[model samples]
Target chain A: MFEQAISAMASVVVDPYLLGLIFATTILGVIIGVLPGLGATTGAALLLPFTLTMDPVHAIAVLATIYVSATFAGSITAILINTPGTSAAAATTFDGYPLAQKGEAGRALGIAVISSTVGGIFSVLILCFAAPLLARVAYEFRSPEYFALTVFGLSMLASISAGGAVKNLIGGIFGVWLSTIGAERVTGIERFMFGNYELYEGLHFVPIFIGLFAISELLVQSKTVDKIIKTVSMKAVKLPTLEDYKKIWKTILRSCGIGTFIGVLPAEGATVASMIGYSEARRWSKNKKEFGKGSIEGIAGAEAANNAATGGAMVPTMVLGIPGSGTTAIILVGLMVHGLRPGVYLFTEQVEKVYQIFGSMFVANVMFMLMGLYAAKLFARVSLVPTQILWPIVFALSVIGAYAFQGQLLDVWLALIFGVIGFFARRHGFSVAPIAVGLILGEMVETNLQHSLKMFDGAWWMILTQPLALMFLVFAFLGLCGPVIFSWITKQKD
Target chain B: MKNIYLVPLILSIFSLAVIAIALQLDTSPEMIVGDSMQARSFPIFLMILKLILIGILTFQFYKNNPKPVALEKYHTWGSMFLFLLFYLLTVYTDMFIGIFVVIFLMSILWGERRVWVAFLTATITPGLVFLLFDYVLKIRFPRGMLMNLYYG
Candidate 1:
């Protein structure tokens, strides 16, 4: 394992073509991240179809690098414009903007860039070591265990801060039902095709993903297209001074740990990680009063955690075929698009590919750090692009992306329809994440359940006989009800 | 329409309809010999589960009594309609035309009052898209009536 990993890293490091692609995509990721309303998920979705013709490892590398670099780029806008480029950077605005407001924009950006690099590097290291081990454990899992794991993944969606728990679950179930629209794999019987030839393969994931994340977001942006953003001027990004690093190194390190853990959990992503990191930094800070008032530690904490989450979120996504966040869910779709199925075979047979991802992420972290430290001003100018102008281009790209995936005009219509459904769903307070997750995991859940029943002679209850499967089911139950149970416990104590 | 319970109510009705449809699926006995779970079985199970969850959701929404959602701006609906038009234009006319028209019209609708700016955006965006996707990637888009006429 060690030799293979080293070999993969060496190959990636020496490949100028791959490195240049990484550099270009990292810059693209930064621009996407620096533009509010174009988060990493949307970026990944829009770029996914374009990557289809490329080699699988290179495609995954491109997508993974984008995910890594975009998380950090969001903080640039958060600091300069008081508008988070992505939801992941929302927490950064609390102190990042105020720091810029105090005319320390360079100093704040320095701390953010360094902290993000460290956190991202730490999480990449974790992903490098942790993913294989987790996949090995998953290798022992059977159909029943896989079914429980997917359910646990869906259950985790309930706790996503997008909306009420019940609403998230509803969205997830609705997505699962949507996944069932095509022909059933087992009997080759069409379930919900309604006699359409395109429905034979079911609703394509790429168009649906693009529609749900990008087009729906475009509609949302249309509501506020007339709004203007004012950017803070910064001469150049400065690395934090030695004294400044002394004050917040621990905070950055702690947030890296926190961010990675939260990111590894299903459904929770960089946004939640950053919020928790900020609050935890406050909880542990020697100068809590400085928080939300341009504290360097505050910037370090949020920036580190959110960037760290980019790597952390890839863990379950590659190991268990379960997405750790909305962005990773889209990346999961990208992975499948490239014919790389996540799970045991990927780790054992395609282990080198996994290490290539780690190498790409590491390079992305270093590349973005250099760009953030030097050319942040250029990227920050991206925020000045008017929403009216930017969104139309994005819509065009989204149209191309949807249509290009299978070269199907019907897919574009499907995207528009889903976009409308997604828009109203969000308007009515539903989070689109669950729907995406459910759609991704729906086939896995149904296939596994069918396999499990076959093995047990159609006695569904026999699944409980398997210890590992039972344990996962228990975890799924806890995942769905743990918060409520814990809240009740607190109430009883009170 | 903004009532929080309305979503669950609609979902419940949809689930019932799906269950009704699922139950009527033709499943041969041979396919169900080894496993009772057949093609329709999973969706039916899902719909049933969804109905139960919707029951919980409706109860939860009623108990929570959340504030009504605000109506979307006209621009939001306008964009959707514009996209629909873009799709039709692409289907009937050309992808390039659809791209040009949507960008131009969407920019206007999105409050870009300067016709030049909208036109510039409209022209430049498709040019870049064609350069990258069509020229570099070599992925040829389907020709529509305008392309056919020009070629003819």
Candidate 2:
């Protein structure tokens, strides 16, 4: 495996075309992430269709670079504009913008880029080692185990709800229902095609992701096109000195751990990770009150944690075929679209690509670190482009992106319709992530459950006897009920 | 906020209808090995799960009086109308032309002050898209009457 990984790394380095694709995606990712309302997920979605034209390894390399760089670029707007370009960067704005206000914008951005790179590299190493070990165990899993795993994945959505668990479950199960539209694989029976031959293969996930992530945000942003947000000018990021790193290395390291662990947990994303990191940094700092007022440690903690999450999120997504967060979910779609099935098969049969993915992420981290140092102002300026102009271009891209893949006009309509529905769904307090999670895992769950039932002669209770499956189910149960129980415990204390 | 439950209520009814359809599906096919868990099994179960979830959500919403949301100052009506109009035009007409028109109109509607900005965006954006997706990537886009006339 080590040899294979080395070969993969070497291949990626020597191939100039793949390197160029990675660079393009890295650049595109910075621009996408510098704009508010477009996160790594949106970056992944907007670029997904273009991947259809490339090699699978290059496709994922593009996606991985985009994923990593976009997460880093989000901090640019957060520090300079006082508006987080991505949800993960929201925590950065607390101290990041404050530091800019104190005229240490260059220093704050410097710490951010440094911490982001460190955290990113730290998580990529974790992903490289941990994912293979986890995938090895996953290779032993059977139908019941898969069903249980899918259950665990789906149940994570319960905690993802900002509205309520019930609402998230509703969103999730409805997404599964949406997935039932295609023809049944075994029986060849048309389920919910509704007379359109296009619907026979199920809703093409790329367009759905694009529409949900990009177009919905576009509609929301369109309403406020006239309002302009103020932004501070930034010239360049001051590189962190060795003494500076020596002072805050502990916080950066701890936040990387915090970010990676949080990211590995299904549905818990960088936003939560960064917040937790900030809190922990505050708790452990010698100067506690200095946290929210342009503390370098604070920016380091948040940036490190959020950037580390990119790698942490990919572990579960690549190893389990289940996303740890929304951005990873979009990347999973890209993987599947490129004819790669994530999970055990990925680790076993397509292990080289997994290494290439890690290699790509590593290269992206280094590339962004360099880019942020030299071109910090360029990305920050991208944030100041008028939303009306930027969004229209994004909208045009959405049309082309949806149309480019599969050459189907039907997909364009699907994207258009879902864009509206997604806007309404967001307004109605439904979590879109759960829906996407359910949609992605729906087939896997159904197929596994069917296989398990066949294996057990319809005795569903036998799943209780399988140790791994039972353990997973118990964990899923705990995951779902933990939030409510915790809230109740806190409420009782209150 | 008064009628916020309308969406949930409609969703609940829709769930019931889906369940009804799921129940009517064929259990097994002729080519199955050893009578496998058939077509309708998982669908029925999933729909039932969804129904139960929707039921609980609807009841919870009914019990807790939802707070009145202060609507945003800018209503999305004009923007939404423009979106739908552009979507339809792009769907029926050629993609390139559709993109051009939508960008031009949306730029103007969304307060891109300079007409030159609109013209430049409309003309240049589609050209980039065509050059990239069509010329470089080899994905063929729909040639609407505009492109057809030009080519002819």
In Å, residue B65's CA in model 2 sits off its true spot by: 3.9
RMSD vs true structure, all candidates:
1.6, 2.2
Worst 10 residues of 2 chain A by lDDT: A159-168
**Separate clash counts for every candidate:** 0, 0
Pairs of residues at least 3 apart in sequence or in different chains that clash in candidate 2: none
Candidate 2 is scored at a TM of 0.95
Query: Largest TM-score belongs to which candidate?
Result: 1
RMSD from true fold, candidate 2: 2.2
Per-residue accuracy of model 1 over A1-494 as CA lDDT, tens digit each: 89999899778889999999999999999999998999899999999988988999899999998898888999999999999999989999999999999999999999999999999999999999998889889989999999888888888888887777888988998998898887788777788777898889888899998999999999999887767677788877888999998999999999999999999988789988999999999999999999999999999999999988888999999999899999999889888988899888898898888898789999999999999999999999987888889999998898888888888888888888888889888988888989999999998998898899899988999989988888888988998888889999999999
Off by over 4 Å in 1: B30-33, B149-152
Cα lDDT tens digits, model 2, B19-106, are 7887776666445734357676677787778777777777877888786454643435565676677766765776677778888888
The 10 consecutive residues of candidate 1 chain A with the worst lDDT sum are: A223-232
Which residue pairs clash within candidate 1?
none
lDDT of 2 by residue, A320-433 (tens): 898988889988988888888898889889888889888888888998998988898988888888876888898888878998888887888788788887887877788677
Interface DockQ of candidate 1: 0.70
Each candidate's chain A: what TM-score? 0.98, 0.96
